[model samples]
Target: MLIPYDQLEPDTLTSLIEDFVSRDGTDNGDDTPQETRVLRVRHALSKGQAVIFFDLESQQCQLMPKHAVPKEFFD
Candidate 1:
């Protein structure tokens, strides 16, 4: 399921983005600051370049590129 980023509370969204960007291997050795990375992700979400996905079985939320998501999810 797709969870609209706008529906999330500001703090919750920030924490989610922070957690996503902070995960090991996410930065790929880049030296970008956490805040910058968070903002970039936020921008991607707003621009429809990325989306928030909620997995039913795992009961976990993930940030993924829009193109990477399965078309069935959009339906």
Candidate 2:
């Protein structure tokens, strides 16, 4: 399921973005600051370039690029 970013509390959204960006391999060898990474993800979310996905089975939420998600999820 798609979770709207706007619906999340400010702190929750910040934590989520921080967690996503801090995951291994996401940094891509760049020494980008955590705050900058979080801002980039937040910008992507606001621009519709990224989305928050909630998996029913695992009950986990993930931040993914919009194009990477299945089209049906948008409906």
Candidate 3:
């Protein structure tokens, strides 16, 4: 269940945007694309777990139990 960031639901996009911004430690209250990393699925884990690598730095974004990614994409 992988999806392009742009294809995410409005609310889902909001959540990810908030998370990304918060994690980056910026609260300027502006949504701007600053050469962000986009994860690509490498492997699928059991029970919805997955191993994704994004960016040249190899950043990982995992969707846990409580937080589930929708199933309809390959990005």
Count the clashes in each prediction: 0, 0, 0
Estimate TM-scores for all models. Answer: 0.97, 0.97, 0.30
Error of 3 at 66 (Å): 27
| Cand. 1 Cα-lDDT | 0.97
List residue ranges in candidate 1 displaced over 4 A. none
Per-residue alpha-carbon lDDT of candidate 2 for residues 11-66, written as tens digits (9 for 90 to 100): 99998999999999999999989899999999999999999999999999999999
- Per-residue CA lDDT of model 1 for 19-75, tens digit only, reads 999999999999999999999999999999999999999999999999999999889
In model 3, which runs have C-alpha deviations exceeding 4 angstroms? 24-75
Show where candidate 2 strays beyond 4 Å: none
Model with the higher lDDT, candidate 1 or 2:
1
lDDT winner, 1 or 3: 1
Query: Model 3, range 5-74, lDDT digits (tens) per residue?
Result: 4455767655554455456445366465533421211122222344222333555553332234334334
Q: Per-residue error at 64 for model 2, in Å?
A: 0.2
Q: Residue 60's C-alpha lDDT in candidate 3?
A: 50
RMSD in order of candidates: 0.5, 0.6, 12.8
Cα lDDT of all candidates, in order?
A: 0.97, 0.96, 0.39
